[model samples]
Target: MSETRTRVADHIKHSPGVHFNELVRALDLAPGQVQHHVRRLLSDETVRRAEFYGRTHYFPPEFDAWERGTLALVRRETARDILGHLLEHGDARPDDVADDIGVARSTLEWHLDHLVERDVVRKERDLHNRVTLVLTHPERTTRLLDDVSPSLPERFVDRFDRLLDHLVEG
Candidate 1:
């Protein structure tokens, strides 16, 4: 799998239903560039889109395995990274996470939502309208064995570095 495709898939797996602009920020690609790959992914049936309010969210298919195709190479590493972050931080809000990790807010939320849906992470909204996140129940035995693994730790690290670089570059 090409690194860009893998990165896009990983981004989708982490944060499903993400918009093109958010994807551009998360993966550090241009808007048109991200849209191009997203269009291909949609055509390939590797991704599906949904509408929430006025926004469209792109997510992996319900029974479609992420382990196949371009994503297989980095799934384990990604899961390890996500899991490590949850274990270390306990819980966090999506926006805070995006800021901390250097990915766009919507992008981080996509990942958080995916983690929640896949049983890798749990999510709850508070009275103040803040979404709290934590690792899912019956924690993953290992990153490799999940029926589906949305590796979070590696993503955390990768985006964190990117965030740092973004800061430095600016």
Candidate 2:
């Protein structure tokens, strides 16, 4: 493999769920260059791709389906915050989690939708049918959580979504 390709592969291996644009920016390579290398990486199965909640994330073939999904969610600031909050607090009411995170309820629900659908979280209801967010695999989720730190672009996108959610709520 060429040095550029090696850089791309190693970045994906280390970051594990970095989105395409972020990868390009992080490596300071042109889009076409990154695309060519990433295509080859994907072709040889040196890397894998997973799409969850409208974002396509790249992995180093070491992550399973669940890990890929989990990584995808955790790569975003809002989703990571929600997961971290639930991890620390145990099962919590949806409103409380939203309030604690200081995100609009709709924004929290948006992330929770993917988080719940991906099995990172489960919405359990009491006899009165009140919803509480519970982590499906707390230990595994915590381990994954500790490993991921979102890129600046990822955090910007998440903050933008929160802004939109607040605007809509208003």
**Full-model lDDT, candidate 2:** 0.89
Q: Candidate 1: deviation at residue 52, Å? A: 22
How high is each candidate's TM-score?
Answer: 0.38, 0.92
Q: Write model 1 residue lDDT over 5-97, tens digit each, in one string.
A: 879988887765455556777788987778888888888988887653354667788523332211232233433445556666778766555
lDDT (Cα, 0-100) at 70 in candidate 1: 16
TM value for model 1: 0.38
Number of backbone clashes in candidate 1? 13
In every candidate, how many clashes are there?
A: 13, 0
Give the per-residue lDDT of model 2 (tens digit) for 54-93: 7788998878999988988888899888988988889999
After superposition, candidate 1 runs with Cα above 4 Å error: 1-80, 141-170
In candidate 2, the residue pairs with backbone N, CA or C atoms under 3 Å apart (3 or more residues apart, or in different chains) clash, namely none
Which consecutive 10 residues in model 2 have the weakest lDDT in total?
Answer: 146-155
